[model samples]
Target chain A: SQQGEEDPQALSIQEGENATMNCSYKTSINNLQWYRQNSGRGLVHLILIRSNEREKHSGRLRVTLDTSKKSSSLLITASRAADTASYFCATDETYFQGAQKLVFGQGTRLTINP
Target chain B: EAGVTQFPSHSVIEKGQTVTLRCDPISGHDNLYWYRRVMGKEIKFLLHFVKESKQDESGMPNNRFLAERTGGTYSTLKVQPAELEDSGVYFCASSPPGVTDTQYFGPGTRLTVL
Candidate 1:
């Protein structure tokens, strides 16, 4: 069973607008990280927020985590056409042999139209 | 520094054939991981390795899938008698020791089982 599920599986906006994606998970997590994938290749790490933290910012990316709600959101301000890609939320949970491993959500596909 | 790398960017094989996918993590990264995204599904963790030792493999689907990391530097995932449901992107990632949450991903191998 997938641990996380992303909402608004697809989103489209103008280049200057902001894009927000939401993710909800089922289990307690050590941290939640967002990633972007372009052309279905490697996934680029965007940002990470620890369970103890509420919000974080890096450049134009903002991430918010709510452990109480078991949810997270990622906001990309001042979106650009180049920002078009698939975004995924990964949650780190306890796995076999006591290793904390990440489980990802179904990605939200965001398209920034120029 | 060079990021993680995966071999045979794409592989097409028959149902009973064998396919081997390789991943080389960044230098000095001893923690390796394997994941995959099936058709229209979320990414799922396959396993984790810590310095040539199998740390976690709870997500591995079955015995037909074998993952090995030699010398804690590079890893390989072999699928014997690949099934149609196995066609998807196989991704490998590595994180430096003690940084288990932030992972660097490799360009995934697109496995197409015909």
Candidate 2:
């Protein structure tokens, strides 16, 4: 089973507008990370928020995590045409007795209209 | 430094044939991971390798899929007698072991099993 599910599977917005994507996971997670993928390319790490932390920011990207609700949201401000890509939320949970591993969501396809 | 690299970028093979996908993580990265995503499905972890040792392989579907990292640098995933279900983009990620939740990815190898 997939660990995380992202809502609003597709989103379209103006280049300078803000975009928000939500993700809900099933189990308790050690941490959650967001990544961006351009067409036919691999994902690039954006930001990571641990369960002990509530929010994190990196440049134009902001990530919020609510461990109690097993949910997280990623906000990309000042979006650009280069930001048009698939965003994915991946979860790290305990497994193999104690080791932690990451499982990914289906991804949210965001289109920044230029 | 360089990022993760994978080749050949795309491969098409008949069912029952064998295919090998290779990944070279960034220099000095010891942790390597393999993931796959079928059409309309979320990306799933296939395995993880830490410096030539198999750290976790719980996500591998079956014996037909085998992953190996030699000299703790480049990794290879071989699918023997490939099935139609094997068609998808295969992604390879690498992290410098102690970095909390940071994984860099390769461009990915698109495998087409016909």
Candidate 3:
């Protein structure tokens, strides 16, 4: 079973537009990270926001986490054609052995048009 | 400076056959993980290896699947008598096992069982 679920299974937008994807989790998380997968090959780490933090930013990517609601959102501003890919949100939990384990969401497929 | 590497980008085999996939993690990374995503499903964790020991393998499905890391540098996952349900993309990831570090991923190996 997966802990996180991302909304908007598919999205299409023009270049320079903004794309937003939302993720909701079931349990408490130590940290939530976002990744980008191009053509289902490899995944690239995008950004990670700890539970204590509310928001984080890197380049054109902005992530917001609301522990109260157990949900997070990724906002990509000024999107480009290169940004077209599948976006996934992963949540990390601490096991009894004190190791961090990651659980991923279903992912959102975004298409950027030029 | 190199990313994680995986061999046999894609494979297609008939049911009841065996398949082996290899992953070479980045040097000096102590934490290694294996995950897979079936068609129309989320990525699920298969196991975790810290150094040469198997720290967690709760996600392994059955006895037909086996994973090993000899010297903690590289790992191999072998499936004997593969089934149709085992067709999916297998991903390998590694991290430094510390605070505020990200997990690096490899370009997964896609396996298709006919």
Please give the CA lDDT of all the candidate structures: 0.91, 0.89, 0.90
> Which residue window of length 10 is worst by lDDT in model 3 chain B?
B95-104
Leading candidate by DockQ: 1
**In candidate 3, how many Å is residue B71 off?**
1.6
Off by over 4 Å in 3: B97-101
Model 1 DockQ class: medium
**What CA RMSD would you report for each candidate?**
1.4, 1.6, 1.4
For each candidate, what TM-score against the reference?
A: 0.95, 0.94, 0.96
- lDDT tens digits, residues B52-100, model 2? 9988898899999999987898999999989999999999988886652
Interface root mean square deviation per prediction: 1.4, 1.9, 2.2
- Lowest lDDT 10-residue stretch of candidate 2 chain A: A93-102
In every candidate, what fraction of the native interface contacts is reproduced?
Answer: 0.93, 0.68, 0.63
1 or 2, greater by TM-score: 1
Model 1: per-residue Cα lDDT over A46-69, one tens digit each? 999999999999999999999999
**Tens digits of per-residue lDDT for model 3 on B12-52?**
99999999999998888888889999995888888889888
Model 3 error, position A46 (Å)? 0.2
- lDDT, model 1: 0.91
